[model samples]
Target: WSLGLKGERRDLAPVSTSYYRVQAPVSTYHHRVQAPVSTYHYRVQAPVSTSYYRVQAPVSTYHYRVQAPVSTYHYRVQAPVSTYHYRVQAPVSTYHYRVQAPVSTYHYRVQAPVSTYHNRVQAPLSTYHYRVQAPLSTYHYRVQAPLSTYHYRVQAPVSTYHYRVQAPVSTYHYRVQGPVSTYHYRVQGPVSTYHYRVQGPVSTYHYRVQGPVSTYHRVQAPVSTYHRVQGPVSTYHRVQGPVSTYHRVQGPVSTYHRVQGPVSTYHRVQGPVSTYHRVQGPVSTYHRVQGPVSTYHRVQGPVSTYHRVQGPVSTYHRVQGPVSTYHRVQVPVSTYHRVQGPVSTYHRVQALVSTYHRVQAPVSTYHRVQAPVSTYHRVQAPVSTYHRVQAPVSTYHRVQAPVSTYHRVQAPVSTYHRVKLRVDK
Candidate 1:
């Protein structure tokens, strides 16, 4: 039996017969016998005395509960998409390109290499593959140094197009030289088609054309065409025929003569027989006879005529008597008598006295005389009777002498005297 505890192991057995037999005092027997079993029965139910014992237990209290600490969380999410763009720099040379974006917003910045270079960026030029942005679309562009002093602006309205830009030009001056002196010219636009012409004397001129220009150079002058010269002159001569005949003669025969002055005579022979004669100067003289025996005679001066007869058959005659003798006598017989001149006497007679007497003076003078033929006595008288004497006797008789004596002496003496005178004188 064990003490009856609240939680103890106990054994129980059936109560046997011998039990109650021994009553042992509380300490009686010294020997401890470990009974394997004991059964006890008690009839008195009474309370027993108790002693104090210690006990340990888990405790239950009201404690506060803590949850996971609350913290602010942030999440990163992407915003709605937008487009940004930049422009490529354009070159001064010819340009080409392809576009990267269709609806992109583009911005532009200009940076020129030199101050003279310009950046035309407001309107981007169109290229083959890309178009310039509209309105205020921008680009980054640049330019190099320029060639000339003149400045130029980029034309607007950026088209989807491409073209070449020509260089700028300036005016220059030149002078003419040598023979071709003057020149004239005028200003022109960029493309000059016509040339200006110059005329007149030598002088300087200014000319310009439309375009860029270089320095002035010389050109050749135009050539001139000229005509040749000629010389001096004269004329020609002419002639006529051969007609008429000509002859040369002695003296002046006016057959032919040169042209004569006033009053000049031209003597010509007419027919076969005529004679032509010429005097000095313009006068000519000629004498011509026309009869059975035609003759042409020319007398130079004056002439006279006379005639004479030597013997008489007693025909008629004419006499140019001498200054001293004057007589007219005719006889029927032949006779002779003496005629006295200043110193001489001549004798003449003729038989045919019935005709008148005649005498011819061969030069200047003539003389003729006649003698008495018979003797007879004179009776009536206041007259004288003359006595005839012989040849030598010188005798004179008066009228008073006797007639008978005169007859006797005159007869004999006259007869003998005539015979004797004829013989002796």
Candidate 2:
């Protein structure tokens, strides 16, 4: 709460916004909250405990989440916060998914059940700094929603782009919600989708939903990624809409970010004609209708997402869209409040990934939002740490503005640190 912003540069435009005491430090977020306006408040006061506390309030309501590091912090809420606890009704058994997660200390794999204490649904980020998680799926698996799969389109204002989602799930469950090393959890609803199109509004941030499910609908508007991925000097092609295939992003081509369902074998079918049900199941047929881009499931099925992107460290750079396009430089330097708690009194922001990539985080270091429609994150880590967070309920300036819009702490979850959250979806 001391360092306001050394040489930090920012370009945020809060329209008709008034804030109060929002404190979230850029480095070391030992947050502390007195009493929020919410119904319940969670505290982590244990001196030496590292458990992931999770809570989901009614949608559209005032939802402020905080997830802090666990190392002898001090307080408990009876809710399981350690040893990886899933706060859901349906007990999971053998939740399998092929993922490689090792966040410096813990390595997760949704390949099995959460039976053991150490093994939670975590995925492994590859060499450079690329990893995927099924919405809840730790890695590579389809991280989907139960009924509806929503994907929020990132809107760029100034140079800093913001991805927001206002998802409204009818009746769902927190299949796999907790903190770990990697990420992979699928939202299985349908079988493998024929034309895999990523719909921003519907939140199709799926990873690997058991069977072929989601359709990557082509978003007419080219949604620019706000990630400072300004380092792809390789064959970093402009991957626009759901049509253009990401050819050389060898790092971790999330082209199929929301590949919901356990789509069996993605056959390499040709063009013009489309085989709707490219599945090994019911054998449903797809008309191969007149859609924007060809079917992602077939056109470039199997080896989808990342193209030939292998060792291009600066590859993400070239991928930042023509620099002048957005002229976004003060992107990652976003300054936010850091709520420092006293000894043995830690505050847990539901914004998991506090330790995302523990050591080798992407260009960004901290910040991880919870994508509502199931999908977890796209940008994943942050440039450094806490940027757009909120302070405790101190002042009342949030006055008329929906408290959720104050800042990080407010719509925060939606706010960044690589806020991979579909907050307003």
Candidate 3:
């Protein structure tokens, strides 16, 4: 426990050394382990029923042997999960587990060093979707079981959807490395398999990828998309940089900057209006994007049909489990109206929009104005509908400016009409 840890904590002590149990409180960072029963055999039981806001650890190392039975209800993680190192030896039984955000900087390794048996993680939404079989390398997973029917059923907090996976065993995925830029990465290796789904435009600069691969597949959209692959591809979206070379793979290689393994899945991705990107697998709904949805790489798997997104879509990294709209996070987009007034023939409107909204100009030489706006020269905020700069960047003659309007004015940004005049150089 650290010096300053907040939240409520409870301890339940039992007089048994055969098995230990722990119940953790939400919004907490510290957890005390129940005393070990024996060095030979270990067993754990936990009951979880709550909303986990941010349950993460910088380095979570578990070196033990256990047969764990978990009871869960309404289990939802509505944020980013960055598990730097999670090492466990147990059977995780679960139901309706969902993570709704981008997972970055992940390294998952599971091994049975001394004939240690059965280390598994199961979920209803993650839903035991992957039977990862690899040995010896960085992400080396092997599952040896007779008739292991991996029934892939992806369920969000909403409805029920499904898929299936079948593969032969014994291949260790070694040395998987890359600079990963991702958003809305859903359903990776057992709810840990990540592929980005972005909405809107994407732009990438100085992007790179490096890896040695077995097989590769790539697809590109219009407007100058560049890809550099070292191997052959069957399913590839957007890839940059370079890896060494190898042979064949049966998996899907979508978007990534750097990867060095037999099967590589890490990528630097962006969304529509997204560059260095993958894409929002536009499903059965009608999202009226007034422009082309820009993405470097994207493969729309079997997502939902009733998923609806409206207005100027901002950066909404939505994660969904099958049949569970629990994570169908409908983020509300704010509305920014058009600026009404005249047009400013002012030269060099440096950065009219940035990550936020920046309208820069030489306020000294430029004359500013408001509404009674001009007849032409309407400026839409470069980012989203929410970025309505009330500042006097430009406008027509003097009149009341709309509360949510942007007017590019050239003059002494002497602000009238209670509007702010931002003169950024």
Model 2 lDDT tens row, 155-236: 1110111122111101111222221122112212111211122221221222222322223322222122222111111111
For model 1, residues 194-313, the per-residue Cα lDDT tens digits are 111101111111221111211111111111111110110111101011111111111221111111111111111111111111111111112111111111211111111111111111
TM-score for each model: 0.09, 0.18, 0.18
Question: Model 2 compared with the native: what TM-score?
Answer: 0.18
lDDT of 1 at 336: 23
Stretches > 4 Å off in candidate 3:
1-21, 29-119, 123-206, 212-287, 293-425
What is the TM-score of candidate 3? Answer: 0.18
**lDDT of each residue in 11-34, candidate 3, tens digit only:** 122212111122232121212322
Q: Name the regions of candidate 2 deviating beyond 4 angstroms.
A: 1-31, 34-210, 218-222, 230-425
- Candidate 1 achieves a global lDDT of 0.17
- Scored against the true structure, residue 45 in model 2 reaches a CA lDDT of 20
> After TM-score superposition, what is the CA distance of residue 243 in candidate 2 from its true location, in Å?
13
Q: Which ten residues in a row have the lowest lDDT in candidate 2?
A: 316-325
Shift in Å, residue 156, candidate 2: 14
Clash count, one per candidate: 15, 125, 73
On the 0 to 100 scale, the lDDT of residue 82 in model 2 is 27
